[model samples]
Target: MIITESLDNKPAAVTLEPLPDGTTWLYLRKNAKQVEADTGDETPDAKPWQCETAIGKLGADRSGETADTINAKFDDWWTYAAAWAEDEPMPTVQEQINAIYDTLAVMMGV
Candidate 1:
């Protein structure tokens, strides 16, 4: 099942997949607009980050679990992921400069 949800006020696609081990996996793909706004990527087809959350045995059994229970589990994972993404640190200016320099050197026949 795939549903549309919000992450950090941005639209995201959430997919629910059942694993062979009876566990569930939820995949999230954030909107491209959010990616462009966050990374300044101007590519017409730039792809955003795809994150996955594993629903262990406790949250599995789609047939047995009620809709509310599944929704709650998904909501919890989504909230946690959003918080984690917000807390992630960006590269320092020096680090970015060094990375650019490295890329340029390789491009110019390193």
Candidate 2:
């Protein structure tokens, strides 16, 4: 993963994947929750481990660091993300980040 600043001057996560020719490309994956349906016949059940958020990935990036090492350390990351999503009274930096991405995508053909 390579962290770089967007045109909006915000640090964003860029995941790099290698191609067969030994080249790589970047994809922006902001912190958020991802859910997928479970597959089982007859009986219905949600996947137990599928309810995870992006904290694990963040945690990996912050390995060997204490809780106090970071500012936006998820103490209220969920609420912040939600408020930003709905455009409430106060939005988190992550929400602002989405807007930046939208603008960049349109202007820069991302």
In terms of lDDT, the best-performing candidate is 1
Candidate 2 TM-score to native: 0.22
Model 2 gets an lDDT of 0.39
Q: Model 1: how large is the Cα RMSD against the reference?
A: 11.2
* Stretches of candidate 1 exceeding 4 Å from the true structure: 1-10, 15-73, 85-88
Clashing residue pairs in candidate 1 (N, C-alpha, C atoms within 3 angstroms): none
Residue-wise C-alpha lDDT for candidate 2, range 3-98, written one tens digit per residue: 222231222333334445543332333432333435567435543222212222232333433333333344344333223321235468999999
Q: Write one digit per residue (lDDT tens) for candidate 1, span 18-97.
A: 67777555554433243332435555555444333332222454535543554556666556444443224669999999
> lDDT (CA) for every model shown?
0.50, 0.39
Segments in model 2 whose C-alpha atoms lie over 4 Å from true places:
1-13, 20-22, 36-38, 42-110
Per-prediction CA RMSD (Å) = 11.2, 14.5
